[model samples]
Target chain A: MDPFRKAIKGYDHDRIPVWFMRQAGRYLPSYMKYRQRMGIEEMMSSPDVIVDVTHDPVDRIGVDAAIIFADITTPLSGMGLRVRFLDSVGPVVENNIEKSGISAVEEFDPSSFSHPVLKAISKYRERYADPLIGFAGGPVTLLSYIISDGVDRDLFRVKRMMITEEKAYQAVMTRLTDMIIEFARMQISAGVDAFQIFDSWAGYLSPGEYEHFVKPYVYDILQELSGSIPTIYFSTMTSSYVADMDLPADFYSIDWRIDMKRFSAEIPDEKGIQGNLDPAIVNYDYALHEASKIVEAASGRDRYIFNTGHGLLPSTDPEKLKRLVEYVHSVNL
Target chain B: MDPFRKAIKGYDHDRIPVWFMRQAGRYLPSYMKYRQRMGIEEMMSSPDVIVDVTHDPVDRIGVDAAIIFADITTPLSGMGLRVRFLDSVGPVVENNIEKSGISAVEEFDPSSFSHPVLKAISKYRERYADPLIGFAGGPVTLLSYIISDGVDRDLFRVKRMMITEEKAYQAVMTRLTDMIIEFARMQISAGVDAFQIFDSWAGYLSPGEYEHFVKPYVYDILQELSGSIPTIYFSTMTSSYVADMDLPADFYSIDWRIDMKRFSAEIPDEKGIQGNLDPAIVNYDYALHEASKIVEAASGRDRYIFNTGHGLLPSTDPEKLKRLVEYVHSVNL
Candidate 1:
């Protein structure tokens, strides 16, 4: 069995399986060379480009798993939203739900929309032995981009909708939730060995607000995806409430804000844990010293996977990441 | 004694002393009228404008305390850094520490630099019977601005500096720490009853990183101001590690990410907890219902101060804040 899959299943492995959140990204020089010629949309839609980019990290950096080379907004663009990847300014929705109404999203057919990425996944699976991971943006995080039309730091617009327009908020959430489930199911059919739900913006909400608006939809998605394949939920800045929420996912990929030892103790014993070295430290010369601290913290746990708390920064040194991966693979917990 | 002061001292009060961070600026109509005529620099520097803006919330919204009206970057400008407040971009430091070096900050005499705000504090003290709260930016947060040259959501530049340039980072932290101590002491002498240190960007760091870089500087500033006046330390997205830090501030003003009941239990008994309210909810029609929930959670704690988890948004309705204050003041606990 793949070590990453075995660890998530709570089985003992020879060594801890390791992968960074954004292994197949700009930090790799190979990906950058391709990016210079192709736009994000062009690169995402091409199965050949996707296969090459996704395999680069697994082949060169030696990560245990290969996450699909697709942006979280890829599905939104497929759903007929005018999503543009502006340089530096992330995914911008030209036709936001507020301007075009929830019907725009509700009308989306996930089966028809996600074919290119699914094709890419199928091609990758045909050639690669490593477990391939597929992912979609969590409902609230997707809604944040759709409502705000871009990257909003405060996420005030979405919070306002959640607070003021309850019915409309629910409608949007329901549609997005349904779309994500379909998207996940399609990816599973396309042969993804595992899945991750990236609720990157969920940390912006209070626990009470999250309970009221986000938890039920997330619960639904996780429930739907459970048992088919191992599932992981990832979010940053959510240390205060993540442990207590106890959503029914196989694993929780946490950020660096909280300690792994304390987080492991708080969550149920059956569930596995992934993550959380601060990605910034990977840029430092003493990167392994910091990575070793995370390794030691997770040593006593029943199930653990080593990974960064957040996505790799564009400025990260690939050599450092390679060395860190080598060091984690050498550990025999 | 002021209700806020009494509550901080762990004494029983008539009601939970309620105040909102950023209470004195933006939301109020009177402040907006003033903003139309004067730039933030003019408003912050003028004793009359400062006194009037500082008193608006206490007089109109009826908060228990009066936090002075001033931007966090006011002192950076005072230290001879070329800081400017662009309409929406926030504090832009043209002569950032990276460009100007640490001497620009090291050469700063807090006593000479902070006279305008100190003079404003004195002027407000003579006329206002309400306890006035003064504040300074926390060292790491100040360095984040000084290093990045503006509002950096990630604080990656500062983090990189901390990891790669250790001696430079420590020197900057040392000088900023000393400047804050002097600034707080000057505010104390100017007759302000209490103070807050806003480490607004401290949440960007992991626990271990925070412990190494931010905690000591915060401790030094809090230690210096401990006996002089009650001190409050405010940071957002820090629920995971704030409890364990055990910094020497009289109160910890937390954000909406954590529950007040849980937070109160985790920290020291002698210390006070202020906030945990989602400020975004204050804009809703059912604001009182949300406010009541916070009051209920805080009912059991000894040293509790009712405040929003973060600053009040510019869109917050002043009427809602007034009603929320009335509702909190009516509570017996």
Candidate 2:
């Protein structure tokens, strides 16, 4: 078994399995070359391009895993939402759920929209034995984009809908939860070794609001996917409430806001923990020194996978990431 | 004694003293007239305009306290940094600490620069029996703007400086801490009832990083101000590790990411707790209903202060905020 799989299974390994949230992204020169040739939507649709981009970091940096080269909004296009990737502004939904309503998502065919991503996963599986991690945006996070029609820093529109229009909010959340499950199932069938649900913006909600509005759908999705594959639930700025909630995932990927030793103590030992070196530290000359501290914190744990707290920045130097991977692997358990 | 000052002293009050961060800001129609007439710097410098803007919300909304109308970067001008307030982007420092070096801050005289604000505070104290709160940006938050030259979401540049150039980072941090202490002392001397240190962006650091890089300076400022006047420390997205650190403040104002009941329980009984209604919710028709929930959670605490988790949005209706204050005030312990 691969080191990542072994670690997730709670087995002691000789070397820590290290990968990054955005290993197959703009920071890599090989990936940037493709970005110059075509738009993100075009690159995502091309299985050949996806395979090349997914393999770039694994081959070049010797990372333990290859996350599928796709956006969290990749499945939204299939859900009847017109998704566009702008220059500075991230994924925008032209006809969002707030404008188009729940009726807009009624005709979504997950298999049809997810074909490109699924195809890429299958092709990558054929080419490499390394694990291919698949992901989808969480229900509330997806709704944040869909309700606002774009990237909103405050996500007030979504919260307002939840408060004043409870029934309508539940209807949309149910549809989104179903669509996400279908998308995850398709990726599983296509041979993804692991799945991560990115509830990136869920941290913006209060614990009470999260428990009331978002947790049920997250629970439903994680319950459905648990037996099929190892599941990882990822979020940022949520450590205050995470320990109290009983999330059923094989692993939890946390941001770097809390100490790893403290977070590890709070979480149960049965589950694995991935992540949390601050992405900003990678730019410094002493990047490896900080990386070693994160490694030291996870030293005694049988179930540990090394990764960054968040996605790599666009301006990151790829050589630094390559050095980090080698450094983690060299640390003996 | 005023309810706000009474509550801060951990005394029983007839009603919960209510205030909002950015209470005197863009949300009020009266303040907008001044904003239309002058730039932020001009408005802040004109003691008469500052007094009017600061009183607008207290008179109109009936909030318990009046925070002075001034920018967090108000004292930077004295430190020899050129500050500009762009339309959408926040305060920008033309000659940032990175470009101008520690020598740029050598000639700062806090009293000379804080004259307009002190005059406004003295003017407000003569006019009202209600508490007039004063504040300055915490050392790390001030350094973030000075180092980045503008608003940077990630604050990567500041983090990089701390990692690669520890000595320079310390030198700049020491200067900022001393400046904050001096600025805060000027506010207290001007007859302000209470002081708050807005460590707004300090939440970006990990607990370990915050302890190593930022906490000592914060400790110095809080220690210096604790006896002179009631000191409140405010930061967002820092709930995860706040309970562990021994911060010496009369009040800890937190953002809405965690539960009020939980946060209140974690904090010791001697210290006061303020804040944490989601500012976004105020735009909804049911805004007061949510505000009431916050009051209910803080019902038993003698030292509790009612406030929003963060600042008010510019788009917020002033009527809703007035109604919220009424609602919170009506709640009996």
Candidate 3:
């Protein structure tokens, strides 16, 4: 088995499986140059360029896994949601999840996400035999972004819709969760080995709502995908509920807020664990030093994946990331 | 003794001391009318207006204590360091902490504070005869706003300066800590009953840096205000470190990220707790239903202060808020 698979499974590995959340992002000089030479819009428009950017980190840094180069909203984009990536504002979706009637939204089906995304995932996988992780947004976070039509500070619009226009929001979530489960299932069937359900905005949900609104939807997705591929339920700024969150995720990816050593004790033994480091700390000179400290912080845990509490910031230099990969490899005693 | 006062002292009260974090803001029709009549500039400028807004929830909603009405950067405006409060942008600054040479920064000349603010503190003591609380920005968080000149998605400039411009950043923190200690101390001198240190951005710091750069400054602020009045340390989005983080503050004003009952056990018995409710939960009836469940979740805890994990959003309606407040007070054990 691949070392990355071994690490995610908590089995012995030759070295720590190292991969970054946004390794395909703007931080790499080559990624920027690739943008200039290859044309900015061309990369996202073509499967080849997307896959090239996806594998760039692996070649540049020798990372153990290659996450497919795609945004969480790409599926929605295929479903007629126009998205504009702003330098400062992130994604700007002109159209939203809320249409006047269900019939109007039915025209924009998520099943339409096939040719462009599948091709890109396939090409990215071909570039490496290592663990290639595919990702999709969980129901709550996905709908929150869609309805807001862009990046929101607190997903206020989502909460408003969840309260005032709930049937519409649940309609969207039902569609999205069905799409996501299928989305992850297709990736696993398409030869992608591991998957992550990124609940990027899970901090927005309350415990009661988490149990009712979010849990069943996510559990359905995970349970359906169970045994086929490892599924990581990861959310930043959220450690309030996971020990007994009752999710069906095969592994939990956490932020630095929870003590991972105690977290391993809290969650069931059958479940694998990853992360809890502050990603911004990677920008520190003591990157290796802090990574080691974080590793030691999770020392008593049996199965663990080394990752940051959140995704990489746009300001992070890719070189430090390259150094982090090499460093984690050396220190995984 | 007031339950709020008793709660602060880690004493048993029949009920938890409950107060919404942004108790006095937009939720009230009276507040909107007051802000409209007074204007934001006038609302902040007039001590009489400030005192009125601070007292509205205390008078109307009957919350536990009155936190002083002012923004964190209001004192910077006092210092002639440029700051702005945009309608949508929250607080903005012309000069950041990095450039605001701490060594050159004079000791807080009490004369610099607006006349109304001082008078407001006095009036809250004289007129209301209730427990009044005061606040100051934790050094790093204020410095972050200073460096960014506004609220930034990531405090990269602040983080980068901490690494690159170490001496300058340290001097800024050292001076800010001194000013905060004095500012907090002045509130006591001005007759405020309790103080809170707002580390809104401290969640951005890594545990290592949080322990070193941030905690010491926090310790100094808490230590300087020690025995004068009880102090609380509030961090937004800090669920990962709920159990392990150790700052010298007397209370942890936590967010929705940590479990309320489990969280109560994590903090030392000597310290009190302020919150664990998700403000977003108030939007949905299910969320509202769950919000009440969160109060029950903490039913057995001692020395707890009931509050939203963070400030109430501007969109939160007063009717729902009034119900939420009544809900917390009604069933709290």
TM-score leader: 1
CA RMSD of all predictions: 1.7, 1.8, 2.8
Which residue pairs does candidate 3 place in steric collision? A257-B240, A257-B241, A258-B240, B96-B146, B97-B146
Report the TM-score for the A-chain of model 3.
0.90
Q: Over the stretch B200-270, how does candidate 2's per-residue lDDT look in tens digits?
A: 99888877788889999999999988888999999998987777667999889989888777777888878
TM-score of chain A of each: 0.96, 0.96, 0.90
Q: Write candidate 3's Cα lDDT for A185-288 as tens digits.
A: 77776667789988888766655556766778788888988878888998766676787787777788887666555666678877777777667667667667
lDDT of each: 0.84, 0.85, 0.73
What digit string (tens of lDDT, one per residue) describes model 1 on residues B1-333? 878878877777777898899898788999999989988888877888899999989989999889888877777665677888887888898878777876766545854675577788999889888888899999898888888566766788888888888898898888888878887888898898889999988998888888887898999999988888988999987888898888989988899888666776788878878888888888676667766777787767787888998889888889988988888899986
User: After best superposition, candidate 1 residue B123: deviation in angstroms?
Assistant: 1.1
Distance from true location, Cα of A116 in model 1, Å: 1.1
DockQ, per model, reads 0.71, 0.71, 0.52
lDDT of 1: 0.84
Error of 1 at A309 (Å): 1.1
lDDT, candidate 2, A62-171, per-residue tens: 99988999988888877788888887788888888767776776645764664677899999999889988999999998888888657754668788789989998899
TM-score of every model? Answer: 0.97, 0.96, 0.92
Checking candidate 2 for backbone clashes, the offending pairs are: B277-B309
Tens-digit lDDT string for candidate 1 (A121-211): 9998898889899999999999988885676656788888888888999988888888889889989999998899999989988887888
